[model samples]
Target: MEEELVQQSSSTWPPPPPFWQAFTPENIARIEKSRQQQAEREGVEDASNVRLHDLPRELRALQPPLEPADGEWRVFGDKYRLVDELPKLEDMQIRRLFPNPEDRDRDGKHFDRALILKRLAKSLLLNFLELMGLFAINPEAAQDKITDIRDMFINFHHLINEYRPHQARESLISMMQAQLDRTRAETNAIRDAKDKTERIMEGLGSLKFGDELVGDSTPQKDPWATQREVWASALADIS
Candidate 1:
């Protein structure tokens, strides 16, 4: 009977059918419903995983109102007054530097006053420079060239001190000279290369016009161009 049952199970006609054969329309519908329910459960779980802080406030009153006027309010003794005066002083300085006749009435005639203040600032700065031994021949000569007090003070502190510890003044002069030298050298080199390229092109043009001269004779590339190609290949190999 067991042998007969095994033979029946093995028959191509089938006893009940394989597990895959059992997957009918109803079975497929049930599977789809289960998948949809699982997807909904996962979606709920994902929503729960999101942080509370990331959500928009349900109550608007929980968030603080913007306060732009807080910036305008003076905090701590005379700090705000000093901060307010800085813009007025800066305007005054700019007016003194670039004085306009038309805007005099609107902006106020503070040019002369600004100029006097600038001179006084310069004198005080020069006194400091003199104490630092920045000037050799004349301190007054150095004061005449100083336009921006902030820049002057910064250069005096950092550039002069750090770069030129012993001879700050001399180092400053040397730096300017070196910059000029480098500019001149670069300009001359560029000019020379331009002239050389023009000469090479003129020589190439003079060659007689024929297929023999210009054709398959491996178009004469510039020496610099050939060198650059060779250098590129070498770099590729190294890389």
Candidate 2:
């Protein structure tokens, strides 16, 4: 059995000398130098390849110039609702006080608080005038009884002085509210007519936008004013 055994050796049993060599400083320098030379030779051989600066004229011409990135912009809020409620002029009791707004004296009318008050009184006391006119018999005897009516008229004058502005302010607010409602309806109709992709924004500035009512602000026949003759007549009555 020993005589019959054969010896079989493998040639690839151990590594080569280069594989077993230590990384010395000089050897590393020499190896790096050889690698650089080899890389240069390869690059020269690969003529069709190009670096960034060496891009061909045609390729470079096709590429667009790089632009600076835009990372900021003006920003607006997506506010889309009314902030404050519209003035509720519908429930206000001002239209009953001064139905006419076109009456005004050409001279210093806005400053004439007394004249305005008196005119407002007369307009509000039409019923009393009719009553006084109806009971015009026995002028001297009825004067004492009619004195009550005069006193009542003076009381109404005081009431008008006290409450007329409040009424006017309310009327102004009411008219403004009506104007706002009309404008809102018009705006709504316009928006409805627009395409679906459009955006409608609200609540930017003041809640009461465009409050000018134009024609009706001081309309024809304003009841808060009187002719100077009306003042003379009232004064004569007082005397």
Candidate 3:
């Protein structure tokens, strides 16, 4: 009994108070205040994802500032040089399907962006022959994908004809940039959620793992070795 008392007394002096027991009115009030503040902050931040027309001009879109266009011409022109190279989008296919240049342009812009590429290539080829006289540059040698098309005419090239962006295209680009910004934001949110889950798992791991926990894991009572005979014997003894 004295040993027990000594052990109990030695355990801790003036035992630390419990961190939580039941919610008090003061605690509830503080929690409510914190929740309200968090909600307000979240509401303010959530507005960044939403575009409000009436908001200040600076606050309207959450995209990086687009650089002002220089008057120089830009062309997505590989589409011009590669049209003849494709077995599927052959000269026969283009002539049969879209005989008229106007029809070709309309269909390319409407149905598929590739047709637009074909039209641009033809225009560029004709313009080149008209200006520079015929050289043996085969359009077939040109190759690049949709994004690569952006850089196809970036450097000085006599074959490439530059295209100027119109007011409507600029507006469309602004909208596209906004959409890209939103997509990036959503991607970041998903990544943050994944990180949060990992952090929570790490926190749980920190609590569940320590020298004390490692020591506690040492096997004391185990049931794995007991078999059917042991159970039968135990039952018999009980009876």
Candidates in order, TM-scores: namely 0.21, 0.24, 0.22
Q: Which stretches of candidate 3 lie over 4 Å from their true place?
A: 1-165, 209-239
**Model 1 over residues 61-131: C-alpha lDDT tens digits?**
22234444544543332334323322322343432333233554676545453454465567657766664
Question: Judged by lDDT against the true structure, how good is candidate 3?
Answer: 0.48
Pick out the ten consecutive residues of candidate 2 with the lowest summed lDDT: 86-95
Which is the winner by lDDT between candidate 1 and candidate 3?
1
By lDDT, rank the candidates, best first. Answer: 1, 2, 3
lDDT measured at residue 226 in model 2 versus the true structure, 0 to 100: 75
Best by lDDT: 1
lDDT of 1: 0.54
Model 3 lDDT tens row, 1-239 = 99877886777453443533434565555444544565576675443343223433333232233333542332332223322232222332322222333464654554444454566576555554543332245434433232233222321121121222344587999999999999999999999999999999877765734334433556554445578669889999999
Q: List candidate 2 stretches off by more than 4 Å.
A: 1-140, 196-239
| C-alpha RMSD of candidate 2 | 48.6
What C-alpha lDDT do the candidate models reach, one value each?
0.54, 0.50, 0.48
Candidate 3 Cα deviation (angstroms), residue 101: 21
* Better by TM-score, candidate 2 or 1: 2
